[model samples]
Target: MRTAYRVETVRAAEAALMARLPDGALMQRAAAGLAGACATILGRVYGARVVVLAGSGDNGGDALYAGARLARRGAGVSAVLLGARAHEGGLAALTRAGGRVADDPFAVLARADLVLDGITGIGGRGGLRPDAVPVVRAARGSDAVVVAVDLPSGVAADTGAVDGEAVRADATVTFGAYKPGLLVDPAREYAGAVRLVDIGLGPHLPSVPELEALQHADVARLLPVPRVESDKYRRGVVGVVAGSARYPGAAVLAVAGALRGGAGAVRYVGPAGQAVLARYPETLVHAGPPGRAGRVQAWAIGPGLGDTPGVDEVLESDVPVLVDADGLRLLDPAAVRARTAPTLLTPHAGEAAALLGVARDDVEARRLDAVRELAARYGATVLLKGSTTLVADPRGDLPVRVNPTGTGWLATAGSGDVLSGLAGSLLAAGLAARDAASAAAYLHGLAARRAARGAPVAAHDVADALPGAWRDVIG
Candidate 1:
């Protein structure tokens, strides 16, 4: 699983490593990796023009040391000093390697094949300093590939908040552990692709990780595996309270998703029986409220529920509830609060806004915060669906699950119903809210990726791909 930690956790990890080693050991390790990556990007070290945008802290020190390595290998290196005095040791190292400091601020950009943004790291707050902004802008305008030393300047390390201006990087080589900002949004938008440099801080980390992403393997392990003694009842029955005559396709999609969702049976409860029977004849369809639908191990609700009154019955059920689509729109937070069983809320940015009583743009801007806030407010586990799907639970530790497996094709219509069915089935089969949501997202994304395969795919095709995607994890 790909993981991320807060800035404070990073500093603590760095401190522990620094105490055990000789001075500057960690920074040297970081510089070596940074230099190697730069050499690869530039094709050759010799005669390559490299510009380092130097700042006040150790981040600049890392870039300077990397520049020194390149210069010693015959590259023409230049350090454009953004601070009055750069890291003393790093500046001296660069000069000793035959690197020159740019006498003119604008000259470095024109000749550079690559630019290193050492303007800020996790320690930095607010936006880029006025002096550094123009240089950052120039780097963006350049044809050269811009590589951020630790993180993109002006991006928040902890919250993924790009409150002010920031540098958009082609790549970021981060030291020790990943900052939470890289895994979340806004700041994530600036950071292109990320690579972690292991600086031996693994030993000093906490028992519960700060953030985590489920891979195919991890999701496979978390999924409920049927035993030799398992029966249909033991495997669990998923109750789907979805769709109306107005939008019968939702019920069909939900049942299609549940059939291959490892559930022994799918019990459909809604006004879309004809549609459900038409698409999936095996689904046991019932017409009326969720309470009247007989027994169920878990419940999936809200997709195509419309502005109807029956949804409240499903929301109030004792079974684990997976709320999505129209269910998200029609939810009564008070009823959700009074529910006895665990609830998982899956909402895209728009639905999330409605739940939080905020603007959709506001939810998207601070997705991490919005998800966490919703989980707390409703006392439920929230899966805020987006590029980086974030799962958080109220009354639990602060560890948030961020799904790394995502595709643009997931934006297609009726996609969420399939996800809800998958998650709800898992919950019925007995998994924690966090686990169910995370696993569902992982598999859902894998299915979408397989179905799309670089081309457009219909929602039904995505549902059809679930069995093969699940095999990727278990097999």
Candidate 2:
């Protein structure tokens, strides 16, 4: 699994490491790594034009030192000091290595091959200072590949919030460990690609991370595999209560995803039974509420369920339940909190906004906070669906799972319904709520990528591609 630490945790680790190391050894190690990354991006450093945007902290020192290294290698390096006071030692070193402070920052930025953004460090918040905005903008407009130091300046390292003007880098070279901002959006959107430079902070860091993203191997380990003695009942049945007369396709798509989600059988209860049977004849169909249906290990309700009456029935069941789409609307926090069984709620930004009584933009901007609050309020696991899907547990203590495998193409209609069914199937297969949600998201995204392959894909296309995605994970 890939992990990220909060800024405070990272700072503690850095301080611990610095105390044990020589006076300037830690900074030197960071500068060396930064220079190496810049050189690789430039390909041949000899004739490259490098511009270093230096601010008033250790962040500026790292950039200045890196500029010095590039200058010594025959590159023309210029430093644009944005703060009142730059790192004194780093400035002296750069000057000694044939690097000069720029007379006009814009003049050099226009001809730069690469711009090293060291304006604000991870600790700096509320975006860029007023004085540095235009210079940063000029660097961005230039042909140079903007590589942010540690983080893209202005974004909150812990929350992933880009409140104001922030550096939009072509790539970000982060030090020590991954910050939550680098992995989550809208800050993630600003950080195009991320490269981590190890400064040996791992030994000093805590065991549990602030955030975690599952990899292919991790997903493979969590996926359900039937044993030789396993039967349809033993593998587990997933009850799906979805689709109304207006949206029968939601039922079909949900069932499609459930069947491919390693579930033994799918018992569907809704008005769309005929439509579901037309597409998937093997599904055991029922005409009434989910409680009246035969035994199921888990229940998934609310996809395209316009005016559906079974939400309360599903919640009252002893088995685990997943609430999504229309089911999320008019949801009672008291009922969810009262449930003895595990409850998973899947909501997009808009749905999540409604649940929290906030603007959709707020939910999208501060996704991590929104997901956590929703999870805590409902006392259930929440899988906030978006470009970066986040799975937060009810207690709010465990690390939120950030799904890394997804394309923009996965935003099509009914895609979320497919995801809800897949996650519910995993829940029925005996996985914990957090594990089920994370694993399902990983597979769902991988399937979408496989189906789309750069073309437009329907919700059913993603469902059809699940088997291939599963094979790819296990293989």
- Clash statistics: count for each candidate: 1, 0
Span of 10 residues, lowest total lDDT, candidate 2 = 286-295
Count backbone clashes in candidate 2.
0
Q: Candidates' lDDT values, in order? A: 0.87, 0.94
RMSD to the native, candidate 2?
0.7
Per-prediction TM-score = 0.96, 0.99
Clash count, predicted structure 1: 1
Compared with the true structure, what per-residue lDDT tens digits does model 1 show for residues 1-475? 7788888887888898899999998899999999988888888889888999989899999999999999999999999999778998999999999998999757778768889999877888888888888888888898878999889989988888887789899999888778888988888878888988787888888767778877878887788889999998899999998888798888888888887777788999988999899878888998867787778988988888887556677776778888888888767788888888999999999999999999998898788889889999999999999977999988658689888876888888888888888898888888888999999888889899999999988888888999888988888
* lDDT for each residue of candidate 2 in 1-475, tens digit (9 for 90 to 100): 8899999999999999999999988888889999999999999999999999999899999999999999999999999999889999889999999999999999999999999999887988898999999999999999999999999999999999999999999999999999999999999999888999999999999999999999999999999999999999999999999999999999999999899888899999999999999999999999987778899999999999999799998999999999999999979999999999999999999999999999999999999999999999999999999988999999766999999998999989999989989999999998989999999999999999999999999999999999999999999
Stretches > 4 Å off in candidate 1: none
Q: Per-residue lDDT for 240 in model 1?
A: 92
User: In candidate 2, which residue pairs clash?
Assistant: none
